[model samples]
Target: MCVVLAALLAFELFQPAHAQIPNAAQGYQRELTRVVQQEWGMNGRVAVHAAQIHQESAWRSNVNSPVGAQGLSQFMPSTSAWIAEIYPDLGRAAPYSPGWAMRAQARYNKWHWQQLASAADECQRWAFALSAYNGGLGWVNRDRRLATAAGDNPRVWFGSVEKYTHRAGWALRENRHYVRHILLTLTPRYERAGWQGGAPCNA
Candidate 1:
């Protein structure tokens, strides 16, 4: 936690600033939790995923990113198109349907996890996998190899491997900050709910 806090306070690179959670999501919480738990596991990720959707798209069903990412998940066109192909029903109504968008986000988050295997516990898994969600899986793997080559623990995210992320071609401050922000802000909520990955988070 101290490491991430230092990174947040000392970062000199360009990462997009994010706003805090809205006071009222108007049922967004319950619905999002339901959708995420259904598609992902009943694990504590429901809150994390919901927080991500809040940060990513602010729960806007019709939101579009300047980079062509769209929907509640801020998924890129190519990614969403692929998501739609696999989740035909959910993708059919994406970007315009809040429910569908959340569903798609859940599925996509799962896909992100599958992109890499981890011997790390659930908490560390989120640190690595969420970085992949924001950066790219290939970049994360590349950084892992870089960390190993540099005599760092490839699986240690915050204090070790994350340092190598900035060296990867596509790894940027935004991706590093994304995982930190998510865990920092939402871990308590997940821990209170008895989620697997919520412990040891001082943030």
Candidate 2:
């Protein structure tokens, strides 16, 4: 009886909280899959991207944040315009269009990932990339510099660079939560649900 109880407790501890995928996420899976593959190749972190979209707008294509971020990917107007301008193939800035938003998000993630080559590992790199996505790459760089000055390893994220942020309290909290929620929480959930491209942090 004790052994059986221990096994049940272990199962409960290992099980994911909210393991079921959101219904709204179902409609965009195909498009997201294609965009992630197109941008990051076949082994792209599709589950991570899906979790990002879930965090951004909960797969709602028509929602808008009070801060003016719009649509499924929750891009601000200026950012949408900038992304479209820099990547001409993306054409006009249409944050409301599901197809456009998915592609733009995938492209933008690739862009950030490419710039964060100094991270200690893929997990650290993606944490920085996601932080850059939530806040800005400038903030990530600034925090890394601060971390270095404090004698911490700037290449690491968890207890290193994440502890050296200079942003406002609210901004810092949101940015940290955004990175953790997407990478540690939601990414694993999506991976277990059979989304392609396994979680990087888990890898």
Candidate 3:
């Protein structure tokens, strides 16, 4: 009984840390995680940003947002071209190539997060990076400034932003659904990997 309890406790502790992120996520999410892990040396919960990508593009390689963001991770054409230019390894083909796009996203995500302290954990940086990825860091910054001016909580994710406050459009709805999907998908994987966060496989 003691041995069984110890085994259960060990599994519980190691579960989230060893949680297997999908190697391929039907389309964009898979390609994106490959890049993130390959280029960024990020895996496990540290690479949770893949969840954000899954939510955003649902693995579409050639999708363009109504706002004109393009490709798997939905980069703005200018952003895509600019990244390609800087990392010429990410050439014209890079934007269209899922593999290249993943590396590019990893590079971009790394660069963006490097602006913050290295001591920060993945959860701390991932959420901020997701905000930047989704809403544009400039937009997020502008919102923060406005919130600061208004004496609101400028640092947290409370619904202080005008769009969030107003429940703007399908972005919020779609994002929520996507995040939920990632969470649900992860729960099962976590269980299979011996995580206590999920129902028993035998049951």
Candidate 4:
């Protein structure tokens, strides 16, 4: 009995593989939390990214950009197709299916994040990856190099790269909203976890 109980406990700790895919707005928050946690090394970072996604699309699974982006993560159709290639069955399936789109986007995000492994163990890595996820990695890389050369503080996002890309202005504004939403919603839990971004407002 004890062994069976232990196995159940272990199973309970992991979310279902499908937990990262959500169809309803109500479920997106939970699924986003799971995805962020899966992709990000830290819980706090996951919370932050989840908030960002909320800010960007309000958890809309079929959101389409005026320019051609599609799906929950607002991936360009080509990018979505590329991500779909990673899953053979999915490549044959509809790219706009909520579950397929979510999986593809998550895989793409994970790939993008991995490209910055040099920034491992640093919050800036998360920040930079988020920037690249919104903008493009090529632009973010240019900014990173310039910022590094100028002796700028590269640890925190300061909108320094906005000048480099026209898309960045909107991306920066959206990311700021993302940070705010996450901070507001998760502040209580983060504080309880000893969050240092600020003193607990309630305590």
* Global lDDT scores for all candidate models: 0.67, 0.87, 0.52, 0.52
Model 1 / residue 197 / CA error / Å: 8.8
List model 4 lDDT by residue over 22-97, tens digit each. 2454465555446545544444354444444454555676677787777666777666666667666556534456
Best by lDDT: 2
Better of 3 and 4 by TM-score: 4
Q: lDDT tens digits, residues 1-203, model 3?
A: 12432454445454564354443454344444455566656533322445445555655667778888776667887887777777787667355566766677777776666653331343334444555566556755665577667776555432343333223567555543433333334434434543232321111
Q: Give the residue spans of candidate 2 off by over 4 A.
A: 1-13, 16-20
With a 3 Å backbone cut-off (N, CA, C), the pairs that clash in candidate 4 are: none
Question: Which stretches in model 1 have alpha-carbon errors above 4 Å?
Answer: 1-19, 89-93, 166-171, 187-203
Q: After best superposition, candidate 1 residue 25: deviation in angstroms?
A: 2.3
Best-fitting candidate, scored by TM-score: 2
lDDT for residue 76 in candidate 3, whole number 0-100: 82
How many clashes in each candidate? 0, 0, 2, 0
Clashing pairs in 2: none
Give candidate 1's error at residue 77 in angstroms: 1.3
Clash count for candidate 2 is 0
Predicted structure 3: lDDT = 0.52
Q: Where does model 4 exceed 4 Å of error? A: 1-24, 29-49, 87-90, 93-95, 153-203
lDDT of 1 by residue, 1-203 (tens): 45655464344123222224454454577777677667766654666776677678766767788888887778787777788998787636466577777787777778877765672555567778788788678888988999999998887787778888555444477787787777665444443443333333443
